[model samples]
Target: MDGGNNGGRINVAIDGPAGAGKSTVARRVAEQLGYIYIDTGAMYRAVALAANRAGVLPSDADRLAELVKTVDITLEPGADGQIVRLGGENITTDIRSREVTLKVSEIASHEAVRLRLVEMQRKLAEAKGVVMDGRDIGTHVLPGAEVKVFLVASVQVRALRRYQELSEGELVPLEQLEQEIADRDRSDESREFSPLVRAKDAEVLDSTELTIDQVVAHILDLCRTKTAEAK
Candidate 1:
């Protein structure tokens, strides 16, 4: 078993590939623990959104860094959940648009962008009581976190789930969603700095056949156990 029982407050780091229910599980775990849930992925998505607005191509590293510096990124919670504000303007809905998704992987693959965002993520997690979720949280963002959970699921399952969500509003076919999921995994895994990988000490949880509540409960149990030990 993972050792080190102390009174230090716990920080949960959840990492995984695309469509792996990382966001949902992390949010619930944070809510149950009364901790702030910071979505590091949203920061990259915001950068992508800003790049699109500035007309900076993905390869334009200098322009991308400049654009990131000019923006003030903040996380605010609402009744629904967290909202991402860039430059004091809430672009929460715009950041999750299809266009942002298309460009996010490219921007995220940039070393400059990831480094800048990683610093921000670290600052946000400086306080112990936080549950941060992202592709690299377990490995790079919060290596010293008390509990590191790497959530994974089969590509087919993830693709189908994403397709179902998209289909609720738009008419996206299964094949298209599968292709997008595959492409995103490729980008996330192949990125140079802090590519997605489970930390050696991370607890691997495969959600391939589990319901959302089941996964949330699984993570919550771990969180509670860790918190009890740390007390």
Candidate 2:
């Protein structure tokens, strides 16, 4: 992360588990604050997708690390949402597919891959005014962010929210999805390379019974307070 604050811009880091509405909330919060929204999870998914296509297995850490460097993944603002491009090819939707989802955690576990992506992430936040959301945003990516939040929800709530986001045909059984999310939580927390963790200074917000707008509003109020304090 940038070591110096340039001005009034606030770097908001939202970290949490999968299916906890981090991306949606982060985007809304950033839009409301007029800050740049970076979904680092999508960046990992992009690497996963590229590796899957190149006949590379997730265990091939060295190769996967090299592949991601050449892929040149980039995130661009889009009318519908954030557009993720790989090697300059628009693959926003592709990266979100189930295949990539299964590979992302494993791919992200590699130290080299994480280091390379972290460099890119830091560069994006150099000018501040950024709201970056992902598993380790607060703990690892931007530890010094002005505002840090670890958003979470109950397993059932998370599964249902994720279920609602998927199309009818692509939907997985709720029970199975919940189990998978639980398993993912385990993997994320157990991983050796900057495992998913909440920063000591980060405030936790449980969204098990909260609405998206409510979550965004809560974060916004926190951001405004932090911004004022910094000023």
Which ranges in model 1 have alpha carbons more than 4 Å from their true place? 1-8, 167-169
> Per-residue lDDT of 1-231 in model 1, one digit per residue for the tens?
233442355889999988898888888888887888998888888899889998999889889988877767999887888899988899888887888888898888888888888998998877677899999998998998889999999989998987766735667778887899898998888888889999998999999999989988988888888877765
**Which candidate leads the pack in TM-score?**
2
Give lDDT tens digits, candidate 2, residues 1-231.
233556688899999999999999999999999999999999999989889999899999879878977778889899988999988999998987888887789999999899999999999998999999999888888988999999999998998887888876696898988998998999999999999999999999999989999999999999989888876
- Using all chains and alpha carbons, the TM-scores for the candidates as numbered come to 0.93, 0.96
Model 1 gets an lDDT of 0.86
- lDDT, residue 104, candidate 1: 91
Lowest summed lDDT window (length 10), candidate 1: 1-10
lDDT of 1 at 150: 92
Looking at model 2, how many pairs of residues clash?
0
- lDDT values for all models: 0.86, 0.91
Reference-based lDDT, residue 134, model 2: 95
Report the alpha-carbon TM-score of model 2 versus the true structure: 0.96
